[model samples]
Target: MKSLPETLPDETNALQKMVLDYQSTVDQLQEKLKWYEEQFCLFQHQRFGASSEKCPDQMELFNEAESILDSLKQDDSDLEETISYQRKKPGRKPLSKHIPREVVRYELPEAERVCECGHALHEAGEDKSEQLEIIPAQIKVIEHVQVKYGCREIGIG
Candidate 1:
């Protein structure tokens, strides 16, 4: 776009204001045109550019599954099939037995051991879990024992 004609130094105030407004409108239009040009370029690229999902051999797109199967068959002939191999189960490794254990029993008191149905609770079973305790210059096992009690009469404890 050609540059706007410069306003004369002695031009009237109204004329100068009109020129300034026209210049601003021209600048805004130019900016909009540049933005439209950029959009056109991007659109052209997207419509015509090489697509990542497109197959290198365009003819194979129709028979992609068959091509894959053929390739797999060819690959299988060159590969060896394993019969058996031992796989270790994933779990937390057991703590060392050498560590001295401090047994902490979580058993119910003698008074509380009685069932709510007036029947005395009997020792059913217990669950034992161990945690490693780290003290300065010393490592020991803290064994937690949760004793279970059951009321045979009410079948609840």
Candidate 2:
């Protein structure tokens, strides 16, 4: 069998130069990838991580929550003592009747009071809602009254 010829000196040098150039390109790409990874980590930390600026009342609220949770850690027997036969749904208290009230009434237009069936509508009912308003030195209640109209002929309201 014939033996292979050795590479010439200039060919060897050219091959070495190509290898060095490829190595430098790979090194630069790897450096860029590492920088991108660091930036991604930093962005994630800034976006989804816990906030650093905290309200002064936050620590107190945390301690209060911890204390309430600790108090709830009771014996099983105590749980039975805390139960009632029926549970009442929580609701807001009715505003005080002693407050001075200012009523603002709203009604439909005269044209709108007529039903589509050519029948005149009558005052069926009124809905009332109260809002509390405070001035510089006085507090008063503003009650809203919206009158509802109903058609009697075809019962379309």
Candidate 3:
């Protein structure tokens, strides 16, 4: 039989091996947990956060248009001669007549319609405004059924 001191060394070596194996397993599990956490966070952000990414090309185009407008304004101001140009007047665009409209007539109260002079105010032209409303798209599943016809006949020959 081996002495106690010799056996002690072998037992110590076995214990050290077990400890190393456990430590390695723990490290691998921790690494996998960290990766799963990162993936979860990314998925959550994609689902709940803003969907649009800013386009660099669009930004560049907008900046270029603004610069062109600024340069035109500067040139107009620097010219000593009076430049008479007809500028398009900005006004409310007329709503398409084809679109169905829900006419809401807002009339003043009967008492308020009469002036202090006791003369009834005549109806002037009404002002009209249009607003575009949108309905969100809906998803639906349609089930299709097909009919099959089968012919059964006995052999005559």
Candidate 4:
């Protein structure tokens, strides 16, 4: 049977230093937390300023700061729990895999026209409207070119 080797004094000293380093990181995190809180308050005040009454940019900043503050608070809590109890709470959920819907715009050529059958025929109208359908995530777009003669006799070949 093999006996386990005991920890040397040097190893113990290194471990103690590592713990102290972690403690310093926790202190720095606390300072950052305070700064973020102050920024959040400032953003809120800007959003509700009397001059504008409601600044959309300021409101967006306020919301972003608030969310970051919440995340920092969760991180701080997790850090404290790690230091004292060596355990952490569950963190934020991963992003969803679903693709988001997007609005796509395309300009039809000036030579396009609408036919009696409700189909937009080429070289018929200046203005055209279409309700584009959303393509699936896996689908790809392809474009094709077509040329037609106004008179069939012009294309006898």
Candidate 5:
């Protein structure tokens, strides 16, 4: 039998280089996979988890136009005195006039109308209030009929 060479052959060197290249490629792919996994975790938290970051102030965005209008309306005379106005108390707004209304009246009985002193009580000023009500939508169908007349003298009707 022939004895093996003390140094590696050219083919063995090429195979070793290919093995090193494959290992490096695998390592790069593993690093990429780890990065993608971390990104996915962050995305899931943003989509489902309660956010800890403070929201951007939206009132300033909405008030920007109002402030611009007020600036445009400013005058030299008005700037001398800082005009101040009282702010009204906030409460429920009045109902729209377009909505239909139903009125109901309540009257006292004839016997109860009389006062304890024997004089009859007369009607006075009344208090009024409004309430909102919701009614579900309704569906219905309508039928149409047509009538036809024929003339005896005419060939077509």
Candidate 6:
């Protein structure tokens, strides 16, 4: 036979080229179908999605859809293969585990005191509770110094 021309000779040659192109495309589609069939077989035997046990119904439906789409795409080579989709779980909040400090109690020692009689007195029962006591944010102190004049009189200050 003579060497094929650089381009199609006529409409018949063009149709032959189209038929060959279609056959090559079909072969490619067949390969893809084989691969997808292997993938689906793997999916059906064990885990379908990331967590098949958790959402078996949903995963089963998804796998079935994928299988059907694969079959359909094999015939219609132009259509794209179906991709798997998954939903992400919401983030969990961390719990606080801190413990609080307990309150403590104690009594103060008796304060020293001097009377007008110029003698020290021992503890009388206990200091009576003062009513209407208000606690400020901070403690305060007041100092008093008295000047005394003496002419050998009773000790007074």
Task: Compose the digit string of candidate 3's lDDT tens values, residues 22-118.
Answer: 7899999999999999999999999996566556466678789999999999988877875699888999776556654554456666666554445
Clashes of each: 0, 0, 0, 2, 0, 0
Q: How well is each residue in 2-73 modelled by candidate 6, as lDDT tens digits?
A: 335665466888768877887899999999999999989888867654643665476678789999999997
Q: Which candidate is the best by TM-score?
A: 1
Give TM-scores for every candidate, taking all chains together and pairing residue i with residue i: 0.44, 0.43, 0.34, 0.26, 0.30, 0.24
Off by over 4 Å in 5: 1-91, 138-157
Compared with the true structure, what per-residue lDDT tens digits does model 1 show for residues 1-157? Answer: 4444573445589777877888899999999999999999999989998767567788676699898999999989988889698899997888888889999999888999888888899999999898988999999999999999999998764
lDDT of candidate 2 over 1-157, digit per residue (tens): 2223564245878768867877899999999999999999999989997677577577788799888777777543366564557887897777899999999999998988988888899999999888999998999999999999999998755
Q: Pick out the ten consecutive residues of candidate 3 with the lowest summed lDDT.
A: 148-157
Deviation from native of the Cα of residue 126 in model 4, angstroms:
54
All candidates' lDDT scores? 0.86, 0.84, 0.62, 0.56, 0.62, 0.54
Model 4 misplaced stretches (Cα beyond 4 Å): 1-10, 49-157
- Tens digits of per-residue lDDT for model 5 on 25-111? 999999999999999999999999767545567557669988877777774435566559878999878766666666554666667
- The model with the greatest lDDT is 1
In order of TM-score, best first, we have 1, 2, 3, 5, 4, 6
Cα lDDT of model 4 by residue, 1-157, tens digit: 2223464245778768867877899899999999999999999877875766355578788789999999999888856433555566786543333533333435445455444444444432233222323466453323222333132223221
Candidate 5, residue 15: lDDT = 65
Give residue 43's lDDT in candidate 4 (0 to 100).
Answer: 93
Give RMSD to native, each candidate: 10.0, 13.4, 26.6, 30.6, 23.4, 29.2
